[model samples]
Target: MQIEGSVAFVTGANRGLGRAFVQALQSRGATKVYAGVRNPDRLTLSGVVPMRFDLTEPASIAAAAQHCRDVTLLINNAALGKVNVGALDTAFIDLSREMFETNFYGTVRSCQAFAPAIVGNRPSAIMNVLSDATWFARPMVSAYSATKSAAWSYTNALRVELRETDTQVVGLHVGFIDTDMARDIDAVKSSPDFVAHVALDGLARGDEEVLADEQSRLVKRTLSTEDGYYLDPPPLV
Candidate 1:
């Protein structure tokens, strides 16, 4: 799908990679971008319209879908992580639940709510910002990784389900990005602007999957190891 003049709804657009997505789409000549955020006031982006949305709330998702009826592309960019690393510990179970609720259930809700909008526009698309952790385990972010893995699986199923409709579903997998989310992590991170550029280009070119950085490419190449190296479960201890 051509992004120029296409309407897009990007969640978590108040900052970080989400903010970059808004700018990237605008730079590509998107007609209108609905920057969805839980706290709309935090978004002061001049060219985009701010739409109030808390992804974990089904009603809020529906409201945003209704509010952005012209949206041809839905970008699932929001995620939740724990304050501490050991999410497998009983003490962090609540955070684990919240992570899944926000990262997995919330994504599904957004997809359902926006399907009509995308279908109405016909031949539109959905871009899910997944992570390389979907394949490789990140011990410190075990719970967060689990959530993204679920999203990765769901995106695969969704791609097949939407094939007949010609509504492109692009799954984007990237390593750590130079955003607040990866600020303290030592991993080499890509700039959010670069990730957005590659992702949008992949979406327009009808690419089923986009590995945005070298780390993501490495993970994909290693996924077929005989020992299932890339699929290892996060260490609990």
Candidate 2:
């Protein structure tokens, strides 16, 4: 899908990678961009329409889908990640459930709600923002990782289901990014602008999956190796 003259709707567009997506889409000549957010007041970006979209709320999702019927590119970029120290503890379980609510089920809801519009348009696309956590687990972020894994599986399934349609389903995975979500993590983080550029480029080229950084590419390569990264949970260092 060419970004030029396309109408896009991006969730969590107020900040982070979502914001980068909005900017990139505009820069690439998207005719219109809908910035989906829980609170429309928070959207300060110009040249994009702000819509009230809360992924956890069915009504909000439905409303946004109804309002943005012209959208050809659906960017499911909103997600939740809360770190928990103990993977087996009740706190971890609760947080994991919350993460899944946003990362997994939310993506599903958005796809279902927007399918009609996307399918109505030819050569449309859905870009799901995933993570390296989908392929590996860290003790501190086990819950978040599990949610991403579920999302990855869902993205795969959705891709196969939509194979006959004009809509393309694409999954994007990357390691830590230079965003508020990784503010406390002291590590090499990819620039959100660069990741967004790679993602859109992949979509235009009809790539099914895009690894936005070296870490993500490395992790994907190791998935088939003996004693792969997913086999053992890594320490939180």
Candidate 3:
């Protein structure tokens, strides 16, 4: 789990939290950092090597695995979200499916493709970027919340499955982050640099789950309470 001398492959590394991950890994002394992006031309980071791939494309996922055979840290950070304005509208269903395609199934695909390379590599780790949405619901982002919930479940299962191999499976959950993904949201957002720092710190310490911000930590603490936080919708401002 030590970042020093490790090889890391991070998806969605062109921007946002993914970019932060690439920078943090390099700063922590990773020997090689493979930055995965749909368009390799977009990657401007100096130290990281860019690899072209899309989460929704099976071939791309397979190719990345084949190409980054030495990667010991697999970070699944790519995600998409489309607003679902109305539950009764067909567009809502379509949006939900789209979100799941990237957030849920894409994560599974990445894990499946990279697990073999990381299994026998002692001190290796897999980090899945999840969200506070996994534990709470909001009308404006219902579809996103659902997809994150599914991903959270998958991360838990993957952790247990990879237990024998000693490959650390870390789930990173946070509320809104100060990234393009939350550009329009007015709520307080954590800086991507700070979030990435906490996530990498958790990985080094072999923590199973990292709640990156106050909101995420709050939501996690309420998960086991009777009539949990999810029971009531937050009042709209």
Tell me, by TM-score, which candidate is best.
2
Candidate 2 — worst ten consecutive residues by lDDT sum? 228-237
Per-residue lDDT over 1-101 for candidate 3, one digit per residue giving the tens place of the 0 to 100 score: 89999999999999999999999998999999999999998779898889997989989999999888898999999999766664555677788998899
Writing each residue's lDDT as its tens digit, candidate 2 over 1-237 gives: 899999999999999999999999999999999999999986799999999999899899999999899999999999997788766767987888888899999999999999999989868999899999899888788899899999999999999989789779999999999999999888789998999999999999999999999888888988899977778745545
**Candidate 3 error regions (>4 Å):** none
Candidate 2: the clashing residue pairs are none
Candidate 2 local distance difference test against the native: 0.92
Pairs that clash in candidate 1: none
| CA RMSD (A), model 1 | 2.3
What are the clash counts of all predictions, listed in order? 0, 0, 0
lDDT of 1 by residue, 1-237 (tens): 899989999999988899999999999999999999998887788888999999789999999998788989999999875544554566567777888899999999999999988988967999999998888665677777788999999999999999899899999999889999877677678999999999999999999899999878877887777766576643433
Candidate 2 differs from the real structure by a C-alpha RMSD in angstroms, to one decimal, of 1.1
| TM-score of predicted structure 3 | 0.96
